[model samples]
Target: MSHQPLIDGFEFATAGARQKGRWPVRELPRLRDMLASDAGEIAYELEGTRDERGRPGLRLSLQGTLELRCQRCLEPMPFEVGADEVLVLAASQAEIDAEPADAHAPDRVLAGKEMPVRDLIEDQLILELPYAPRHEGCAAGAGQRADERISPFAGLRGLMRGKH
Candidate 1:
């Protein structure tokens, strides 16, 4: 019933432990309520691995789908983002530095004892959001019509003809 089950099997015993797995995630309207936005039913699968370090550090591959509004057309746009995310769940900077630096160096350091998958998913979505969202044909159609209506640089063409 709870979406948290997506991360149920993830092991947090060590920082370097591999957690390659998959989970079905459904984003209900309630989830978007927290973001102060209304959205439709979003269903997607999150597939990735969490490379844990010694104790509690994790490097996660954040990949999933997010159904959101297109900035230009105001239509539903489903975005699939695959992000290589690293989260260092260490108490302090010293603890993070103590870990071996590899391909999974965390972009952010967590100053806590536990790593919550929900929180991580929220952060990843925020980071993956585009500044502007538009449907594939939204801009192309308008541009083509504008081009047909008026000649681009029509006055310049006249000037060049006169000079010749």
Candidate 2:
């Protein structure tokens, strides 16, 4: 596949441009680390605009399915990744640092001459991934079935119950 194109953040926002494309899952480093199988596609849409507060910003949307290992079952679990983010553009690192980190505020990023689109999309996917993914209604016995599991404290339990 051809390399994804980069954008000039400042120029894009000034031109009010929009872009949409798909990125191979294997290409994203951080997202790849969490995947059980890095064989999928991440669809992304980006629009450069001015926010309600008149701040130059980029709106990003990403959607994809990732095969992640279920923390409980240790099996492949399909996880749907969806994220929408608005990043306020800062001209320099100093400007970004000056902004207070508020939970309710849109994220701020330093605008660069060349912004790697894939990197931005990958960051959003990483943020949306679950810390410990688990399948809904996973196969029975997948996680420590009673019949197969041996309790570490079984001997102590028997002693405490006067059953020894």
Candidate 3:
């Protein structure tokens, strides 16, 4: 939807709501820090459901391409991103904090009547990005060059031997 929608997590799950939308990359402020260029769009689908644990949750799926800087070559690179996550709903921040950390459990979040769909979508996409982006070929070349470089201390060996 073009207009931003406020989601009521509890009601959404009860009604089994589902929606799909797209957002321009430039629209997400947090993602801007990671992107080399804001020139793409992210497609996302969100569905409400109750997990096996009987907790109300949202299932989010996202696909997009991001322009990112290559760490090795410092050039622009295209990164394909896809993510899917289930966020369990909690009545308040305290409720989420009270739950013990479980690696096998889905993440918990405070559900609100006016949850911003755009912010949720952006959060998922940001998590999908690589911490360090690089071009495969460039990375290999950089590694080889590093191995071939001579150490500046090479001359010190001759002086130590009284050959200088």
Highest TM-score model number: 3
> For model 2, where is the 10-residue window of minimal lDDT?
155-164
lDDT of candidate 3 at residue 132, scale 0 to 100:
64
Query: What residue runs in model 1 are displaced by over 4 Å at the alpha carbon?
Result: 1-15, 18-56, 93-106, 139-164
For 1-164, candidate 1 gives per-residue lDDT tens digits of 23343342234424234444343344432335333244332232333334444334345566656666765666677766676655534455555456554433444344434445555555555555554555557753364232333434333322221211
The CA lDDT at 133 in model 2 is 66
lDDT of 2 by residue, 47-153 (tens): 88888899888889888899998767789988887888787788876665565544466777668788889767876676666666666666643454443223343
lDDT agreement of model 3 with the native: 0.73
Each model's backbone clash number = 5, 0, 0
Model with the higher TM-score, candidate 1 or 2: 2
* Alpha-carbon TM-score of each model against the true structure: 0.50, 0.79, 0.80
Cand. 3 TM to true fold: 0.80
**Cα-based lDDT at residue 72, candidate 2:** 77
Poorest 10 consecutive residues of model 3 by lDDT? 155-164
